[model samples]
Structures are given as C-alpha cells and as structure tokens.
Target: MIFPCILSGGIGSRLWPLSRKDRPKQFLPLFGGESLFQKTAKRVNHSGFSAPIVIGSNDHRFLIGEQLSELGITANSILLEPMGRNTAPPALMAALIAEESDPDALVLLLPSDHLIRKEEVFLEAVRGAEQAARDGAIVTFGIKPSEPNTGYGYIKVVPGEEPVRRVDTFVEKPDLARAESFLKDGGYFWNAGIFLYSAKTMIEAFKTHQPALYEGLLAVMETRHSDLDFTRLDADLFGKLENISIDYAVMEKAENVACAPVAPEWDDLGSWSAIWTVLDKDEDGNSSLGDSRFLGSRNCLAYADQGLVSVIGLEDVMVIATSDSVLVAHKDKAQDVKHVVDQLKSEGRDEVDRHPRAYKPWGY
Candidate 1:
C-alpha cells in the first residue's frame, strides 16, 4: 500500500486578498465550495492508496481535522510542526515514522495545494513509479510543460525509453528565453515537487546526503508526542534542524534519483495568471466566478464573492473582489501580487495575514 503524505504548511502569498496567512489558499473553497486540500485528499484516496498522513502547521491543525471530517475521512496521522522548516525535515520525519511499521513502506509526498486534473492518469503515473521507488530510487513526478512557464523549477531528465528516467540535473526557475529554449529543447520537465520513495530508500538517501539533518530529525521524531488526535513535534528541537527543500537537500545531489514524466493537466496555481490559465474561459477569453460579468473584455479573470462584479472595456486584467478587500492587476503582472502583500506586511496590516471570515475550531 502507498501512503500519501500531504504537506500543507505553505502560506501562499501570491494569491493574496483571497489567500491569507491564517486561512491560506489551500483551505479556501476555490472550486464549488471544495478546497484544494480537500481535492488533494480525495485524489489520493483510491484503491492502492492508504489513509493519508498530513504534515501541517500548528495554527491550521483544526482546519485540517475539520475539513477531513467533513468529507467523512479519517487521517492515519496528523503531524503538527511547531514552525515552518520547509520540506526536508518533515519528509525525513515521515519516512522515519513509516519505517517503524514497515521498512519497505512506499511514501508518496505531495503538496496539499496543487491542482492535478485527470485522476486516472495521475494514478497510472503513481503505479508506474512504484517499481523504480521499490528499487531504491527517489522518484519525482515531472510535469511535461505545456508552455514556457518561468514560475516552476525544471528537471532535466536523461534520454531514455523507460517510464522512470535518471535525472540529469535540476535547474532553478529560468528566465523567459531560457524557459522557451527548454520547451524547444524537449529534455526538460517542470519540477512538480511530488515525490515517491520507500521508507528505507529515503532513509538511506538522507543518511548519505544529509547526515546532520537525518540524525536531528530522527531524534526529534523520537520525542514526538500525541496531543488529542494530532502528533506534535518538539518545537525547540525541530527549530534547530536546517531549513531546506527536498530538491536542494536530496533530489539534486542524490545518485538514486529518477523523473517520471507526467502530463495530467497539472498546475501549482502559484499565481492568479496560473488560475486564469486553468479555469474555463469563454469565447472572449474571460473566466469568472460568483456574480461576475465581462463586457468587451478579453483575457480577463474576475472573481466576485459578496456582490456583482462587471468588467468593461478591459483586456488582460484580473479583478478579485472579496468581502474585505479587492485586488485588480493586469494578467501579465499577476505574479507581482506578492509585492502588494509585502507592502502590507511592512505596514503590519492584518489583511496581509488573514481574512475577515477567519476559520476556527468551532466555526468562523
């Protein structure tokens, strides 16, 4: 059986005004009152998958629990991090715990906030990567790029006919020209940040590549205690561990790494432009939600929550109107929404952190 380890700790700052610190984008109902986290949980709940193990922030523990409960699902375990330390340490901790029950446990580490259409294809990819993962390979699902997207990292896979190919190299986010070149070059895949590996295989990789992190997280996991239904890690000890992503700590340097090319209509939804790209656009190239209407507008996205929103004589514009705030940006500058968040953070504005309809243990 494969265990899905969902990492739900990121505070998505790019989709601000809608995505907030307290109630991040993952927890919000982005699609028909179903959150991305809920969608992710449902996606991995197929026959070959086991009950999920969630690794999330201390602040959003109740949100995770309540959301899962709402869907009539019970998690295998909920591990609470005292603070954010990126992916490396928490992944290591999950592997260590899984190894306790079964040494050969296959752990599928995925972000709680990605949009992957075509569930059958995604499952097929997971099944195909199982063999490589069992053979001691840390397999990462690499999305076949549909365009020259500069927001995502790139994975250079070696030329091969196999479903799982050796990773040639991992590159940072490329500029426009470089991204276009990679698309034309045809050997690169978008680093989707989804990984599959056995407990023993990942443990061995950590022991070799990151010995200090391996040992520190091992010790910290030993001291992990259960609070109600959630597992709580030692805050002080976890804080002492190095803060790094799995790509930088293991996948980039490890010899036993492979890339599984998957093109199942995947998107990280990191920005409003990405959201616009995935949504169903009309003939005029406009996407909308809530009470929204567009007139003489092309390539525009309008989201209205509390009232009617109309866009007229606009092109390549995004308008997100919420109960408390509104964000209007050009489609090309969708990624720059974080700058507004930064400015608000500098002024210590609560709007930068959370929404007015805050989620809590009981109710909003």
Candidate 2:
C-alpha cells in the first residue's frame, strides 16, 4: 500500500502578514477558494493512494483535523511534532507509525505548500517514482528548469536521460554565473523536495546516511505518545534533535538517490513574485485576488481584503493591504520582504509576521 505523508509544518515567515505562525501559507486561501493544504491533500486521494498521514506542529492538530473534515477528507493519522525538528525526524516518525500497520508500506512524501496542478502528469510521475522506490531507489521528484534560477537549488543528474535521471549530486542555490553554466550544460534539475520510498528503505537510508538522526529518531519513536488520532513526539527529546532538512541529512549523501522528473505545472510560492507568476491577471497584466481597483497598471499585483484599494500609475509592483499591515514593494524586491520582517522582529512588531484573522484547530 502507498500512503502519502504530508509534511505540513513550515512557519511561512517569508509569506508574512498573510501567512503566519498559526495560519501558514498552506492553510491560507492564497490561490482561489481551496487552500494549498487541502489541494495537496486531495492529490493523494487518487485511485492508487491510501489514506494519508499528516505530520504537523502540535499547534496545528485541530487545524489539520478540522480542515480535512471540512474538505470531507479524513486522514488516517495526524502526527504532531512537539517542535520543528525538520523533515528527517518527521519522516522517521511517520515511518515508525506506518510500519505498525503495514511494515512493507510505500510512503509518498508531499509538501503541503506547493502548487502541483497538472494532476495526470503529477500522478504519472508518482507512479514512475513508486516503481523506482520499489527497486530500492530513494526517489525524488525533480523539475525541469525553465530558467537559470539562482533562488532554487539544483539536482545534478545523469545527462540526456528523459524524465527519470540518476541523481549525481544535489547542489546548493548558486550564484548567477554558476546558474547560467548549469542551464547551458543541461545536467541539472530543480529540486522540488518531493520524495517516495518504502518504509524499510527509508529506515535503511536514515541508518546509513544520518546515523545520529536515525538514533535520535529511534529514541523519539520509542517515546512516541498517542493522543486521539495523533502521535506526539516527545518535546524535550525531539527539540534536542538537530534541525536539519532531509536534503542535507540524507539525500545529499545517499548513493541510491534518483530523481523522477515531473512537469506538473508546479511552483513553490515562497515569495510574492511567485504568487504573481501563478495567478490569473487582467488585461493590463494585473491580478487582484480580493478587493482592489487599478488604473494604468502593468505587471502589478494587489491583494486587498480589509478595504477597497485603488492604485494608479503602478508598474511592476505588489501592493498587499491586510488588516494590520500593508506591503507595497517592487516585484524585483519581493524576495527582500523578509528583510522587512527581520526589521519588524528587531523592533518587536508582530504585524510583520502575524496575520489578523488567525487560524485555529477547531475552525477559523
């Protein structure tokens, strides 16, 4: 059986004001009516997939359960992380829990934040990945880079291979010159952070690559406490475990790692600019999600909810007016919005991160 494990615990500090501690980007209604989390959850409900298990923060227990309920979807299990110990530990935790029911279970790991829209293409990729994973390969979904993007990390894979490529190396987000060289060479793919593996293979990979993390995970799993439908990892012990992503803890060092290239119209909305690229806009090349009016605007994005926002003579800019705070910045500088957040944090301004209408476990 293939069970989808949804990793839903990022703070989304980069998507501040709209996305916050309690209400992260995944749960927010950013793209249309359905939240990103709900959309991602629906993907695993396809014919080949079993019920999913969501691994999220303790603070999101009610949120996960309640939201799934509203979507008329029931998760098999909702595991609560006592603290954010990153993907490796949470993956291990889910592996332990899934092993109890089906020791030979194949786990399809998905991030709750991405927008993977092309269902047929995405599902086909997952099927291919499952076959490789069944053959003892630690599988990852890699994206065909449309541009030499320095902001995204690259997966150096075997050249000339169509779709499924044997991962050569996982490279960091490089400088512009290096990025250009990678694009020209044609051996690199963008790391989408999606992966598939069997419980047994995952356990083995963790043991081989991240022995300490595996040991700590073992300890945490040994002390795993269940409450209702959720398995809560021990707080003190889990917190003591190092905060490291799976890419560093395992994928970078693992020899059997492979990339299953998926062209699923995917985008990780990490910044405001990414949102603009994914959204639908008007004739003047502008997109307004809620309430806004624009005149003589070209290549602009304005999200207004608190009140009517009218902008004129705006070009290549983003104006987001929330209840507490509004963000107005050039599209090129959208990535630097985190700098504003940092400044706010230094000044003890909660508006930089916390949204006005906060999400709760019961209901928003």
lDDT, candidates in the order shown: 0.90, 0.83
Q: List clashing residue pairs in candidate 2.
A: 62-361, 63-361
Query: How close is every model to the real structure, measured as TM-score?
Result: 0.97, 0.94
Model 1 worst lDDT run, 10 consecutive residues: 355-364
Which residue window of length 10 is worst by lDDT in model 2?
355-364
lDDT of 1 by residue, 177-203 (tens): 999999998999999999999999888
- Which regions of candidate 1 fall more than 4 Å away from where they truly are? 359-364
Per-residue lDDT of 43 in model 2: 80
| Steric overlap count per candidate | 0, 2
What count of clashes does model 2 give?
2
